[model samples]
Target: MANSKWSHTALLVIDMQNDFILDDGLMRVDGGKAIVPNVIKTVERARQHGILVIWCDGGIYGEIFWLKVVREHDPQGRDVELFRRHLYSQGKVGPTSKGSPGAELVDGLVIKESDYKLVKTRFSAFFATHLHSFLQTAGIHSLVIAGVQTPNCIRQTVFDAVALDYQPVTVIVDATAAATPDIHLANIFDMRNVGVATLTLQEWCEADA
Candidate 1:
């Protein structure tokens, strides 16, 4: 879309936290560090185009409690996803624990005072969050997403955005990552198959130009 159309678009910067991007982080995604520059550039371009910038942070205190309580209530972990149940049962404090250094955004990614910040507990930014209402209030009907680990947070958020009826959902391929290149490309292919627009940072920026 053109710059003029970006007023209705919001860029969702998902989980670009130190834990996911830093080499020594608890849950480091190796490719995440490589994409930092592209993500930074995409954010700059989005701001210049007048697109709303929304940081979808994953390590809020409430999320910790939410997961803890949910797992506690379902001690058998029946309510939790099969893959994550073991972690919850073991009482593991994930990378996004509140007030942890891992929860903070990567050093190079900027969160301007004017940018919107939404903390999410689950993979989907819209899950039990006011993101939908906030976006609606701001008249945002489209989204541009960038961040680490395409298989989880990025994919979940994009899928949720689509289910929420956000049109023209776009994911910047080079600006996002997964544990491996194959995993990243695989998720991108899935998103594309679902009608999500997958583009490189350069392509996305030029589209607004």
Candidate 2:
């Protein structure tokens, strides 16, 4: 799959936020920092090859998704009802909530001002966000995905991209993290078996070879 077939590819970095990646945050993915170097390298290589690099950040506010999660686990939980009421009260379940600093792409990425930046409220960037339209406008047919939290955002994004007929080549080295290594590994395996094509960072760098 390497051999100039990826020339029109775009690298979509998803939700490498401070809250999810940095220490001392409300929700941190374990080993999230370890993948940063690989993600940076992938972005740099994509740029060197003149591939489109689009960064996606999830600026999930107040917490409708959080409420859903808690409700899933414990339907009668007070925390679930509290957060659900808060998020619903604020009307933040859609495009109205974006552009927050929490949704900002992480520093240390090699992004130009002209490079694409999209803000999404859902796990799948293609949903509700302008990401799909942006990709279509750019004539992008393939996607190289990276970022944090394999089971959630990364997983959903890859599935949606594939469903939308984009060739999603996922860099496992750069793309994912989980609450535990076991869970991360399981998610990666599931993805590899289904939606996206798995590639190592080195393999993707040699894509033109």
- TM-score: which candidate is best? 1
What tens-digit string does per-residue lDDT give for candidate 2 at 88-159? Answer: 344333112233343334567644545444655556777666777766765667877788778887888888
lDDT of candidate 1 at residue 164, scale 0 to 100:
88
Superposing every Cα of model 2 onto the true structure, what RMSD results?
A: 8.9
lDDT of 1 by residue, 28-134 (tens): 89899999999888776766666777778411111010000000113344444466556435666555566667777788875554444576767777877788887
Once fitted onto the true fold, the runs of candidate 1 whose alpha carbons sit more than 4 angstroms away are 1-3, 58-94
Superposed by TM-score, candidate 1 places the C-alpha of residue 139 at a distance from the truth, in angstroms, of: 0.5
- My TM-score estimates for the predictions, one after another, are 0.82, 0.74
What are the runs in model 2 whose C-alpha is more than 4 Å off? 1-5, 57-101
- Stretch of 10 with least lDDT, candidate 2: 63-72
